[model samples]
Target: MFKHSKFAAVAILAISAYHGAAFAQDAADPVVAKVGGVEVHQSELTLAMTGLDPQLANLPEEQKRVAALSAIIDVKLLAADANKEGLQNDETFKQRVAYLTDRELHNAYFKKHVVDSVTPEEVKARYEKEIAAIEPQEEVHARHILVKTQQEAKDVIVALDGGKDFVELAKEKSTDPNKSEGGDLGYFTKGRMVPEFETAAFALEKGTYSKEPVQTQFGFHVIKVEDKRKQAPPTLEQVQDQVRQLVMRDKYVKLLEDAKAESTVEIEDPALKKAYEEVNKQQADQKPQQQ
Candidate 1:
């Protein structure tokens, strides 16, 4: 499956915290501490909390900020020594800094162009379009009297034939944990049960009990079909978040395509180039081909 880079997820987390810091800066961004004459911004606390030790995330919020402050102070103390030693001038360190800066920029761009651009109306329209394409499925509401042996199952069918109340009979004779609820499985579509049980349940007419015992890995069942109807689609409220993710994914792909069109990418290694093309193909495939 195609997916955005893991770095993108980290970037999103970092950018989201920074986004909040914008409006909350005056109230929340004041200097909480100083290290070696350098001020520590409350905004830095967000990066420290997210980018530093993973353990800090488990700490209570106030304690987390205090730890992050201490950690950042320690980093500054060592970073000052590294700077004094001219480590920042080293070629490897410079390259690492450049790469990190580029990654952070990419993350911020992704957040601004892709994540923030998704709207509720677009998500709802996409959801409705997807839902409309699906075929409605038939589901059955069933109750089953399960027993250890075929004879027990057959006897339950005979009792049902004698017009015994299915619910009361299930409570009296079934060993299932749900026996208290009359062996009621409620409503389910096909493929939700063992093949034997699902087949028998769907085959029985509504309001009728299976004439014969149905055997499955669970033993024998005397299933009674209570009702059948078209399974209802999930409500928009139940799946809005997921549909929003789909909208974001499509937008990200479009953004990538636009950027790729404007840039020059030359790969000298043939094998690496082929592999890169394959990955891009997957990304391209994630969006439907332009009509």
Candidate 2:
């Protein structure tokens, strides 16, 4: 039964593809597969598979080919029916085709000029330059006891002063979700925490808890700074793929900028003209802010 089902599935796909090419001239291409006097081509199958799910791409070569052939046949069958009804002449169909064609062209150009041109050496150089420019920033490992009120936070700090284990107190009393992990926040750089909490946490010495309850928008917190160290930049192997993406994006932006500068550009619509000017002005203003 299973073998019959499989053969039926393959037969249906071949038939669909054959019917899809029914409108095309029989003399156009000998590559076409004929089903009931209809034609299907290899290109149709290839294009069909290009849009398949990513997981399908991982299938064994034979299975992938079979799936692609099936999908192409289905697409051809639908296309033939649509043509028969003259749906191809519809305004909506024309617009959809135009949009899809333009998007595909843009993607093809980006892949050819930017993505394909990016080399490993370029990515490595960009990463090296970025590492050189980065200033050593301090990071801290800390823990906190969160409470609903200032009084509750104050009591927690008092317990800390009397030699109670910060983690034990946090587990028993803290309202924050991290209480289960003994309030360990792991390591983080400055500006990651709220200003009030950051200020108190950064000022504390290693192994010392905040003497007072620190008030913030979340609530009151009793913080203990566990350690402080210089932040380490990511190693090349750790972020090689990310570095490649950054380099490619930078190249893509340059390509577009160069194209725009070299082109004869015009905006015929008044609303679009005004919007374009505003965007240009905003971008120009941002340059000085960065400086």
Candidate 3:
């Protein structure tokens, strides 16, 4: 995840403004703080506080003010010393500052155009459209007695036919873990179970057990169909937040694509262009995986 380090820098800036002798000794609006004739103003402290750590925002008013002032003073002292050492004239320092400035501008643009512009109505409309396109699905409720061989399954059927309770027969003869629960498989939709088992389970009428044992990699099964019903779709309220995220992501993507299409974007380096395209493709592929 991306993180912003602006808060740390701003806090230090705020500390510098408050502790310099000019502000501490003077009693006036926009109090000027000076360190060897370099002046700092209280307004600089206010601007620095704008980027303070969000977690510190809820502190008591006095504590927040004190911390902000302390941060401004520290920033001023370090900055003054750095200027004295002539670091500001270094080419590397200038390049680093330029890079950070561009990055901040990019982030501000995304916040204004993508994050802030996403609306609740758009999210709800997307959810409704998705819900309307869903198809009703069928599910089966079933139970089975699992045994090691077809002969054992046939024998279990014989016992059931001879009036032995299926639950007791399962308890005495079945090897599956569900034998403890009378072999009840509860409810499941198609594609959830192995093909052989699912085919036989769904083929039977309600209350009927398979006369011929079904074979699967798990073993042989004498399955009983308990019930069948159409599976219910999830209600919008149950997935409202998920739908909102999906809609916002779609909007953000469309906005980016539109901007790119409308602009003259030239990649001067072949390697960089390839890397950028690869990253976009990777992100596109991962969106479905996230869903």
TM-score of 3: 0.62
Cα-based lDDT at residue 172, candidate 3: 81
* Inter-residue clash pairs, candidate 2: none
Q: RMSD of candidate 2 to the true fold?
A: 11.7
What lDDT does each candidate get?
0.89, 0.85, 0.83
TM-score of each: 0.87, 0.60, 0.62
Better of 1 and 2 by lDDT: 1
On lDDT, the leading prediction is 1
Q: RMSD of model 1, in Å?
A: 13.4
Ranking of all candidate structures by their TM-score, best first? 1, 3, 2
Model 3 C-alpha lDDT per residue in residues 132-248, reported as the tens digit of each score = 778878888998999999999999999888888877887788899989888999999989999999999888998889999899999999998889998887887899889877876
Tens digits of lDDT, candidate 1, 109-197: 99999889888889999899879888999999999998999999888888888888999999999999999999999999988999999
Error of 1 at 127 (Å): 1.1
Error of 2 at 114 (Å): 0.9
Q: RMSD in Å for candidate 3, one decimal?
A: 12.8
Q: Top model by TM-score, which number? A: 1
- Expressed as tens digits, the lDDT of each residue in 172-251 for candidate 2 is 99999989999999999988999999999889998888888899999889999999999999999999988898788778
